[model samples]
Target: MIRLDVSRIKNVPGETLRLDLNFPMDPVQSQHGQVSFNSPLRLTGFLTNEGGKLKLTGCLEGEARIACGRCLDLFDLPLKAEMDEVYCSECREGQGPGGEWVLFRGDVLDVTAEVAKAVLSALPMKLLCREDCRGLCQRCGTNLNREACRCSTDDVDPRMEVLRKLLKDGN
Candidate 1:
């Protein structure tokens, strides 16, 4: 959990603060699979007191380990998420435009959720170990990247039998 002390600038409007924060990030479960962070997440930018709200704008950077979508191999992935989240002192916890506000009470702002959301959204939908990664064979389950598969490659779909028959008849 990462918390920021905003008491100094809470009541002072138009006050700006430069922030450089680094903290470890937990493993995130994504649609593709589990993504575990190998390095600490770094948020570097400024926080300005905007009258009644605290606006935080920063760039997040980290390294993570995830599986290759095509070959199912584990590899290191670099992460960089741009964030501009608002911390509202007057609004309720769950009220915002598409979860835009990070509700805070007293003089502290908990930015863990917003950071996690930014990292999650920054992850690519398709992860690949290499550009030309040949996926595993369906029948024999062979890693084509390492070695050649002995599975038969001439098996045609039954639905395409009519096209083959028509070509053969024409010949």
Candidate 2:
């Protein structure tokens, strides 16, 4: 967990704290797929004490192994995310248009949940091994990129048979 001690900068408005850290993360499993980080996530940025509130801005960089949505292959996915958050001394529950505002309960600001949230949000909705990934065949479950499937590709849907017949008859 990443914790920032805000005891000194609590009341200082213009005081800034610079940070550069590497944190190890556990494997995360979601409905989409499983993601595993082989190395520590590198974070670099600064935090400013804006009166009693804290403003944090940083960049997170890391690599994760994710399953491709189309091909179902495990491949390395590069992770890069920018974070800008506000920590108010008072309790605030909603996100702002620019960023998010969270409540800081005590002198310590634990950013573990924020980091995980950022990384998870940065993940792609559809993971592809390549831009032109051919993916698996629907009929035979063949890897189309590596080899050709013998299944007929020209078969039309039964629902469109009436239209097909009309077109064939030039009607």
Candidate 3:
């Protein structure tokens, strides 16, 4: 469903095209979220040919909901990614095999995986709603950012009792 047409530029070497593609993510991609998001994904990009090989360059813009690493809050984050890669008919499993320039042979090229790769690579290692988010309290499971809890604050090192008593007496 995400195929691109290229038969028109068979003989032309320097010819290029500006394509607007709408990519829908498979159901499997929704597993990344805490909740299910059964929405279709939209991605936009361009394809061009320079020298002998064809190149795919584009940007993906969308929104996805991910759980915050600290407060466990579910928030929507705007996703934007830019990528430039050469298209090859025969792809090697590993790098260093030397990528062979693929001649534009077919009428269409499926750019779904290419777009997916770009989006996946741009994901953050740790998702967060904001930088200064106060996480949930360990004792009462209260969101510290929202309100202060009545949980005991006596959980301190016994070695510092002398200092605690000194501070308590206003010494």
Candidate 4:
């Protein structure tokens, strides 16, 4: 878990703290799929105490392994994300710096959940091995990028059969 010791910073406003560390994280499962980090993630950033609120700004750098959305092949994906979060010492439930806030009663602030969220948000909507990946042939389940398949490419949807017949009859 990534945590920041803010016992000193809480009493001193305008104070800044520097952070640079590497830590291992568990795989994150989402609606899309599972994502696992290749190695320890490097976190670099600073935290500043502005009045009674603590503002954390940092960058997370790492590599993640994910399955390709098109070809179903597992590949390495580079991860780099910038994060900015705010914590309040006396914030009530559902109140925060920008409509969302973390409440802390002690000097230590755990940021594991926040970091995980940042990683999730940084993921691409569609993971591809390459920009122009041809993907697999739907009919024959063949990798089109490697070679051509024997499946006929002229197959039409059942819903379009009526329209196709009308056009063929010149109607």
Candidate 5:
């Protein structure tokens, strides 16, 4: 649980507090897959007390262990996620713990789940081992990065049979 004590600036209206937290984090599941944090995650930002609502604006920096989409190899990926979250201590009459505004009580604010969600959403769509990663062979199931495959490139689509026959006769 990532909890930050905001007792110093709780009652003070329009007070802005700077927060910097560095700690080791466990693996978390994202939309693509599970991402492991081998290095300490750095969360640095400022919290502004707007009336009774606290606005958190910060950036999370960490390194994640991601699998390559092409070759399926695990590699270290440096990640940075921007966070702009809001937590209300004194909520509105109709507002509860669901929606854009998150309801919190007391001095300590637990932002573990929120941080994980932000990092997951900021992940890249494609995870590649390298820029010029040679993927496995489709026919022989051989990894092209390690060695060349002996699969023939003469395979033709059935629809191109007429074209092949025309080429043979024209030649």
Candidate 6:
């Protein structure tokens, strides 16, 4: 619902503006998570007008719900993101370790896009429930933390069985 309006700076060369944004997380629109509100996404930065281009340099910070890697329990993930980008009428394509980054489109800069990019890039690949969670059992599919399983523990070593038998016969 927060739409950043930069129409005033359009086509103004060397114009600069500093802004702060606090966006509340709406779980209903979140990629994944229940309807729980999260900490506001704080964006503090400046945009520079460069005639036919715009440059944005800023840091974005916020908190969102994330599942624990081991336990699957939902928790809060702190996000701190820093971005430096240049927007132009002509798209600039560049590559990095992961892949290429596409610069934002022309004259009017969309602040919402800048914030979303920062947040998404900073998110973790995997979410864990807890650090010390006992995962589900492989044989019975029972959650090890909640219940115990009747799995076999009589593991035998094939190479040492002959020696074990010889020792029993005093050979």
Q: What is the C-alpha RMSD of each candidate to the true structure, in Å?
A: 6.1, 6.4, 7.0, 6.1, 6.7, 9.3
Instruction: State the lDDT of candidate 1 residue by residue for 50-107, as single tens digits.
Output: 9878999999898878998877988888899899988888888678888667778998
Window of ten residues with lowest summed lDDT in model 4:
162-171
Error of 6 at 62 (Å): 0.8
lDDT of 2 by residue, 48-167 (tens): 987667998999889988887877888888999898888988745774544467877878898887887778888987788887777776668888778887763457677676665465
By TM-score, the candidates rank as 1, 4, 5, 2, 3, 6
Worst 10 residues of 3 by lDDT: 27-36
* Shift in Å, residue 72, candidate 1: 1.0
Instruction: Please give the TM-score that candidate 4 achieves against the real structure.
Output: 0.79
| Candidate 6, 20-81: lDDT as tens digits | 97877444323444423367778788877776466778888877676554545567778888
Segments in model 2 whose C-alpha atoms lie over 4 Å from true places: 28-31, 92-99, 145-171
- Where model 4 places Cα greater than 4 Å from the true spot, the runs are 145-149, 152-171
**lDDT winner, 5 or 6:** 5
Off by over 4 Å in 1: 93-99, 152-171
Better of 4 and 6 by lDDT: 4
Q: TM-score, each model?
A: 0.81, 0.73, 0.65, 0.79, 0.79, 0.60
Number of residue pairs clashing in candidate 1, backbone atoms closer than 3 angstroms, sequence gap of 3 or more or interchain: 0
Error in Å for residue 14 of model 1: 1.3
* Model number with the top lDDT: 1
lDDT-superior candidate, 2 or 5: 5
Candidate 6 regions with alpha-carbon error over 4 angstroms? 25-37, 89-108, 139-171
Candidate 5 — worst ten consecutive residues by lDDT sum?
Answer: 162-171
Of 3 and 6, which scores higher on lDDT? 3
